[model samples]
Target: MKLVVEVKLLPTPLQAEALEATLCACNTAASWVSGVAFDRRTYRNFSLREHTYAEVKTRWGLGAQAAQHVIKKTCDAYATLRANLTAGRLGGPGSKRHRLASGKPIEFRAAAAQPYDDRMLSWQLDARTVSIWTTRGRLKGLAYTGGREQLATLARYRRGESDLVHRDGAWFLLATCEVPEAQPNSKPVDFLGVDLGVVNIATTSDGHVMAGRRLNRSRARDHELRAKLQRKGTKSARRRAQRRRRKEARRTRDINHKIAKHIVAEAERTGRGIGLENLTGIRERVRLRKPQRAMVHGWAFAQLGVFIAYKARRAGVPVVYVDPAYTSCTCSRCGYVDKANRVSQARFVCRSCGFVDHADRNGSRNVRARAQAFWRSGAPSTAPAALTGLDADGTPQPAVCRNASASRQ
Candidate 1:
């Protein structure tokens, strides 16, 4: 399993400047290569490599590794763009469908950090410092600070490439490390279901809730503050707003990490697989009012899912993503499905079975049921039936038992 650990770095101003300069040079080189690739519709490394090294090193004062990394990144970007285009993922106005990009090379707006491979970087555990290459040459004694556990973890594994980032006013090293997988579980009894939402963040079938009201409130405050600062139209206000946004993002990320850790640990301790909603493209699927859309779209449901999955994998807890259809409206007690079953955002009253429970909790139970059905079928997960299906004339069909088709996986 691969994980990234952010280690605070202590670097001289000159060293920081050098790193930033190298990143800028990398971005410049990539832009040139990407422009060429886009024009020729060539993304292979060999084709892209033909433009590298000699001219790049002279043009950007980049070392051998830095130049190669830039060319590689440009090729990768074009490859990704091609793949997405092939999948029909990229389209609409202003998107490149046929014509090449403008003559001006589309440069990376942000400084593209130079990646270090084993050939260009080394870490010393005793000194807590890393030797990384820069445009000027190799820069040694770049100190890193992190918890003892993090330091030990980094020392244990073969460290992958680490990106040097300049955020706000601090210089930090984002270190990637590979850790061994946990022992396999002999038997798993049941599954723990997690329902994610903007209100509570996560609600598990075991009756545990990680409330998100406070987080939501904080996010609202950030939004208000940003709008207010922007209206002021002052340089200082802009800078202050930027700092606040960064702080809010860091705080929210920390909370998510904690929540993911707790949920995964619970599943591991109880020897149960985890059931999570398969919410891919949920934002596009669900319609919301303007006010509600902002809140729902701002929440990081996908990031939380990723965090939960990776942590569960490291803890030997199997995870299953169930069809999210009818998970919220279906009654876990009687398997009744109806939009009216959800009386409110937080309350659920089943007209079919008279079952009453928290809406998210009910959804979590339904998620668990679907996961169990999927496990029994022993096949890839598929989307659950829609909560309210449409008839031949496009009228909403009354909710009824639709698990028969679902059972076939």
Candidate 2:
């Protein structure tokens, strides 16, 4: 896995200004290259190299390595633009025609940052300081701090390039580290169904729920604070409110990380893969009441999914996405599907089968069933005893992964 760890830079005023100047030169070089590529209708390397290598050094006064990196950055952008234009012209699904494909010159916004490749960037003396080739000269003694664990991991698995970014009155080194893929030895026998919702962040088919009461309260508080700040009509209040909102987002992300860790640990303990709904494009397809829509939009289900996926990958666990249509209403016991089956927000009463259960749990069960069927059809089952079929009580027939979530203390 490739991950980027951001480290705070502690640079002297002179060093900061020099680095900023270097970044400006590189961006100027890149902007020129982008315009040339579009004007000539070619992003070929040798052509760009011939045009930029000497010109950037003399005109932009950039270092040799910095000029090369600039050419690489702009050429990559042009390559992507050309590929996207081709795909759009071919009518590929979800690929819209780019405005630049109409022959308008591509614009590269001026910025005080540059992407440093391995050839131009390296640690100076130790992890504290880093050295980079700048336009003026090689600047050293640029120190960075924090991210102790990330630094350790980078030392263990450093393999990729990093981008130096200047944002919010700070210079940050966004370093990337690659992790080796774990061997696929999980041998999952079944799946643990997880239904994501607003009230409850996650509901497992095993009848356990991770409630989102605290998250909802935090959102409400944030909204109230925002409204009050707006009413204050002061510039400082507005700024404070913005900072508070960012803090709330960070807090919510921390909680989501914990929840995902717990959920993946449960799946690993049960020797099961996780089943979830394929909620792609759900926002555009589903319309809800004003309050419900806000809750839905405010929720971080997508972030939770990403967290689960990465954690599960490292743990050698499998994840499956199933269709979401009618999952809440479908009867887990008798396979009966009707919108009326979901009698309330939290309750599910199957009219045809007279079965009762929590709505989210029912949805989870349906998701698991679909995923099981999908896997069985796609891949030969190694263990027939772990078929993930629902029993008469609407629980998993396979006992190996049964009650995995509910068993937690």
Candidate 3:
């Protein structure tokens, strides 16, 4: 499977300035190329390069490979826009959002990430350094650092292009690694069912519940802080809000990672597959009050699902996605489906058989039963059980293999 491992780059002040200048120039040139492509209706790489290649090199003072990369990146941006339009992500045809998106040429941020091929970038894993091309010159011996596992992965399985990303005043290189998957456990004792929710982050069929009370409280505080900062409307306040938002994102991601790691590890240890819900269009399917909407929308159930899928894939554990309709309201014991079964957010009592269980736990058990049925019903053997279908949000994000401190120096 293809995974991306991020490593931090520690550059000298002068090197950092050069890197920043190079990125700005590349993005500026890409924006110009996008304008030309939009005006001329030419989005293909070769054809668009024919029109902008020489000019990009001369105008931006970029080398041959960099110029080519700039043009290709612009083309890719347009291609992505087209895909989004086709998928109605922007809006339906002639809608205001659709018109706004289609009416203008794409623009690249000055600090946008740039892709580097092997010809432009080289890694020195043994010395924990890198040699990369910059507008100033070929910068060599630029120190970089990563977690031990990430460094080992880079040394052993790193492949393809790496992206130079500038985020929050930090530089990182996202290196692609082609890690080999372990032999899958086709026959498992059972499936570990995980029910994802806003109140409880995850409830496994094994009766394990990872509550989200603390996380929710933290988010509420962060949200309140952001609102106050916005109301204050000062530059420093805006900056602090941005930093807090980023910190909150990191915290959420960390929590999801730990939860996913534990779930995958337990499933693998017990010889069980992982079962998840097919939560596509969940945001649209769910209806809640104004106050509850924020909590539900912020639920990162999709991210948690993706994390589980990727980790399960690496551990050679199969994952099955089952329909989630009425999983909460249905009685796991008597197989009776009724909305009245769920008496509250946390309690479930079966009206048919007088069986009582935690609502989320009962939902997880139902999910486990459905997954078992799906697996035994002669599902396709050629398909990869883990992450075979689209992710919860109807998009398959790049599988990121990250550690606790993958980019820490």
By lDDT, who's the top model here? 3
| Distance from true location, Cα of 67 in model 3, Å | 1.0
How high is the CA lDDT of each candidate model?
0.74, 0.72, 0.86
Flag regions of model 1 displaced more than 4 Å.
39-41, 84-90, 93-104, 232-239, 382-409
lDDT (tens digit, per residue) of candidate 2 on 1-409: 5445566788889888877887777777788888887788768877888877898889988767778778877777777566656746435544344543545655555554567777778875365788877766777767888566766765676666767776556787766556555565446799899998888899988888988998899898888888899899799998888888777777777777788898889988988888877675677698899867766877777667766766676677777778789998899999998999999989999999799999999989998898788777775322111122223332221111101110000
lDDT of each residue in 13-93, candidate 1, tens digit only: 888887787777778778877787767766788776785657888887877777887787776666545655565555643
Query: Evaluated with TM-score, which candidate comes out highest?
Result: 3
The superposed Cα distance between candidate 1 and the true structure at residue 154, in angstroms, equals 1.0
Q: lDDT for model 1, on a 0 to 1 scale?
A: 0.74
TM-score of 3: 0.93
Using TM-score as the measure, name the better of candidate 2 and candidate 3. Answer: 3
lDDT of 3 by residue, 1-409 (tens): 6677889999999999999999999999999999999999999999999999999999999999999999988888888789889988899999999999999999988988888999999998889999999999999999999888888888999898888888899998988777777799999899999999988999999999999999999999999999999999999999999999889888998898899999999999999998888787888887889998878878887667767877787899998888899999999888999999999999999999999999999999999998899889968422222233334443323432211122211
Winner of 1 and 3 under TM-score: 3
Q: Which stretches of candidate 3 lie over 4 Å from their true place?
A: 381-409
The clash numbers for all candidates, in the given order, read 0, 1, 0
Off by over 4 Å in 2: 79-103, 124-127, 216-252, 289-300, 380-409
